[model samples]
Target chain A: MKTPVYFDYAATAPVDPRVVEAMLGLLGPDGDFGNPSAVHAYGRKAAALVEEAREEIAALLGVAASGIVFTSGATESDNLAIKGAARAAARRGRHVITEKTAHKAVLDACRALEREGFEVSYLVPDRGGRISAAQLEASLRPDTILVSLLHANNETGVLQDIPALAAAVRRHGALFHLDAAQSAGKVELPLEQVDLLALSAHKFCGPKGAGLLYVRPGVRLEPLLHGGGHERGRRAGTLATHQIRGMALAFRLAVESMAEESSRLAGFSSRLIEGLCALPGVLLNGHREARLPNIVNVSVEGVDGEALQLALRDIACSSGAACNSASGEPSYVLRALGRDDALAGASLRFSMGRWTRVEEVDYLLERFGSELTRLRRIAGAA
Target chain B: MDELHDPARYSPRVLELFDRPARLGPPPGANREGQAENRARGSWLRMYLQVEAERVVAAGFHARGCPHTIAAAELACEALTGSDASELAEYRAEFLEAALPLPPEKLDVRLLIEDAVRAAAHGRR
Candidate 1:
């Protein structure tokens, strides 16, 4: 049987073959498999590979290699960036600002801080799932130590104006953190404007288990992990040299081909949006113009999102609700934008990526239209 | 591709019922109908039954929910048809739960199916 067409790139992308090949050179007996912390020659070689990987990632983000600190993945990067910074700046202030639509990594970190007597203000986004610069400025207070937000939403592909928002945060005398896990390799990032940024390798065709947090010079953070002074005392752990190498290679490839890939994806997204919107009772989620090119989220009226997802078993996609859980909560991001539970629950996120083709998009459109019509008919929608 | 997918996430029986529901949609000229929903969880079910001499002669269901809930609804309709209406009041979610071997978190699906059937029986009385 033919496998299902993958359309959940927002969740995670397959590692690029080039990245895999690079990783293979660092993994086995003949490879640079020694611990990076060892003082031996093999260890030195491994450490060199790690530093080279860091440079590749730094080059893509337009930041100095020294600013990057590797972690297990974005979740750890987010926790380290937010919690570490918030705790370090606690003496100066106890307040923080973030949008409600941010990934759970940021929100949960903020929530953890809240338990420690810190005040967090979750800014509500507009109907298009966007937080304006004015909104950020208004939310910032004298005690606001940091403002963390996503560069691009994982579910809706909504892109925030990071430069404008960063400027607003800085003007308020607060540090700005961008969870660029979703947008790192997909688009250009204004790294100079952000004080701290988090990224994941798996999101951009790198192997999983490795990510980075870029800390701007002069910024102080309370280390989340303490021991052995790894990551310049910011984080402590034996780095996975192979994973880091793969990430660097993946980031390099993504940056090298970003312009052309983005253009191609934009065309595919446009075709998908056009086709989906032509269906009766279909509504697109998020700002049409301010979203990433690879993801198109839509809500089909009168259809259950779970049923639709099941109907489209041949197309791997995600619903706006957390389908993995029993509660099945509609995406908080959509809810923050004022979408009702039913509409949010009915939304589907079709994310395309490097391997996506025009023919697959057409097939998906047809499948979606037919399944939606069938489901609506069964539901007796007018 | 197999590595990319997880088959164990869904039981084969649930997949079978979801792929080919035995009693989907409303039975023609159903004498009794009932609807139940767990709006917070986005699960909804509408059940129709034809009763003759206090016995369910035919049954069908239409549901919009996850695979477990849909499968449960279909399975309920299959189990209830040709049974005495009084059996509905005694119907327990455990029977369906065991048959489907539903996860603990998905016990709500069994309850939803039971609610639809009981509602249908109540309407007939």
Candidate 2:
């Protein structure tokens, strides 16, 4: 059976073997089984390893170890960052700002905040999927307490200018939080100036169940999930030593290989964009130059994304976020970027990864061209 | 090979009944006469069928689906012809027993034939 290529790395990535190896010791009987908060020597060993891993991840991102707090993954981190911050800052202002295309975690948290009576402004992006820095500045009101924007879009790979937008939010005294789930390991992030930021290890070849939330020293957040008070009262749980170690390894590897992977994936992404663009009536969804090197979103008219997806069973792609696949609605991201419902519904998000090969790309191009032709015929356009 | 185009494997019983492919049915269409002549009020596999009782005429159809849907549409028109309310009202999926049975997933197509028979028989055919 012929299967399509796997081009949905932005959704999730296959954990590297190195991460698995690092995790083994922690899961085994010989590993650090004791809790970090315990008084026993085994607990001390485990606690030290967790702290070391935190430092490792911090080093990779060029941040202080004290600023990094471990969470279950990106989703939890986003919730803790937005909901926690919004609720804590509710006394100051109940109004907050964010782009409509943010990952569901951010949006859901904002929605939950909305239920609690905090007003949220979901900024609509321009045609290229960029939330203009000026628009963000304009949206900030005296009542707005926080501005939460994504670092890189999960569906379109659209990269937002963090420092620029953060500066705008800073002027209004609202906290700035960045969801770097898709950008953290693959690209450089401006973590130094931002009040808060979130990251997940799995997006960058790290192990699953490991993520980081960066809260500036002075920022205040009400904990979203209550537990044993493990993460300096910000989060409470026994740290998963193996997951943290694996994440630290993955983070270090990603940082060290960034220069290499970025260039390589950029080349592959360029080839993909060029090949797809050659087809008639196809359009690009995100800012061509302002997006991540590894992601490309394309719209092929006269093709049903679901049908094309079903037809290209071998090549794994995502029409939108993994969370919204069941809804089968047009991508909210593309729609925010001014895409019509039909065009948004017809889009395909192909994100390149560390293991992507030129041959696989070539195969995808062939498959896409053929599938587009067939779908058009079925729709009577061809 | 396109296994879809060959009609030998399928049947033209629906088209044979209406004996007309006027591009209009009970839902909506360009020809007022053809649409008005068939009350065929219901949904075909791809088309919507509506029948008018007063004139025994049927008209108008809208097909927002595929070829199998369009073909089943043609099947709908056949499933309703030369019959009045009592005669064609009894037609059922058994009517399709002699023709190509759609896969389990394509039951929507069968629905088209059923509605067509009821509407055309009781409608303004």
Candidate 3:
């Protein structure tokens, strides 16, 4: 048996071998390893590959290549989109909106904006972790300049109704920024209503250190980095030719196989969730039908979250509690949905991906059930 | 290996007890039991001791907490068994601290174990 079978794909998928193969062509002396900004022949070759990758990624996303501004992965992309859009539109309004359960990148970015004298309204999602369209509409103010939200939540795999939320933001004349790091390649991104969208290649089996933010043609953004005139003055770092190539190729591959892969993963998710919920005191964490197909989160009662994780040492899964020896903090995402600190900490998040096997899923279910029972028995809950 | 299971994060003794806490659950012929709970951290431990002729003959416990807290309970129970009942009053969580090598954040957890042990002793009179 493979040791530590991975089910934490939502954290980051292993880089596809194809992506690795594509990246290798751009490195070393014989490859096109030249500064993309130079007018030399090598530079021109490198630049051409970057442009080709841009076009490839744009085609997969069904958007114009010119709209894509490549950055150093989702965290930077998210910071750039939220801060850039908010700062660019600051003269128009000082108010922004997001949900309480948004990723730390999004939440911390909004918090930083607040320090800059911008007002932010963090709307609480319903019990099922859905930010209703009506709830968003009521929060929109005349001075609301930007509304940043996630298409799919990272922790619970719960997807927000982007189309409805986008329409609400559109009617209120606010620019909508989406942190689609978790949703891109997994779901169809309805960008027609989105003003800015953030994505990380690693989320879809692309290389690390590669990501992009799509800014609609007319959307103005204040540049986050300043020095070089790269990315048409939006992002200013020297282009990472290999990482970008790998990211584009990975995105294309994932999107190409999206339909079939979505169905397959949905089946796996259903099987895993069913097996988990069958266990005594185990609960499915997110909405049954309204979540991403690859991610399954559940909280097991009467087991220490850390102990349960240790028991399943052979299964690489995540606990809702971040278990540093010093601090045991429950996931704020779970807390936002009204889960108590204990249950939230005891939660497990198993995210399957392209490499996941049905046999591995069954093995996980079996191990999870037996280990849970043992832990409960030790805790005297059985 | 995940960092949570890293040997550096916890001692071998801690993992040993956590994997198979031999003193878990109520011991047979237990006339006294005491429990302690940290509602904020969501850690709880119940210690059951069987005392004969003012000396602890057996000690066991059930706990819900991180590995450190659970290990501390198991260690406390092991130390209490076959000792004079007055030793329960003298037993310091500090001893388990060195045995489990608990961090400062988990100091309270060790104290919780001590509280349970002292409670079991208090129930005798």
DockQ of each: 0.44, 0.07, 0.67
Which candidate's DockQ is highest? 3
Error in Å for residue A236 of model 1:
2.0
The TM-score leader among the candidates is 3
In order of TM-score, best first, we have 3, 1, 2
Ranking by lDDT: 3, 1, 2
Q: Which window of 10 residues has the lowest lDDT sum in candidate 1 chain B? A: B1-10
For each candidate in turn, the TM-score is 0.91, 0.79, 0.97
Hey, what RMSD does candidate 2 come out at? Answer: 7.9
Error of 1 at B84 (Å): 3.5
A153-212 in candidate 1: lDDT tens per residue? 988899998878888988988999999988877899879999999999999999989999
lDDT of each: 0.85, 0.73, 0.88
TM-score of chain A of 1: 0.98
Please give the TM-score that candidate 2 achieves against the real structure. 0.79
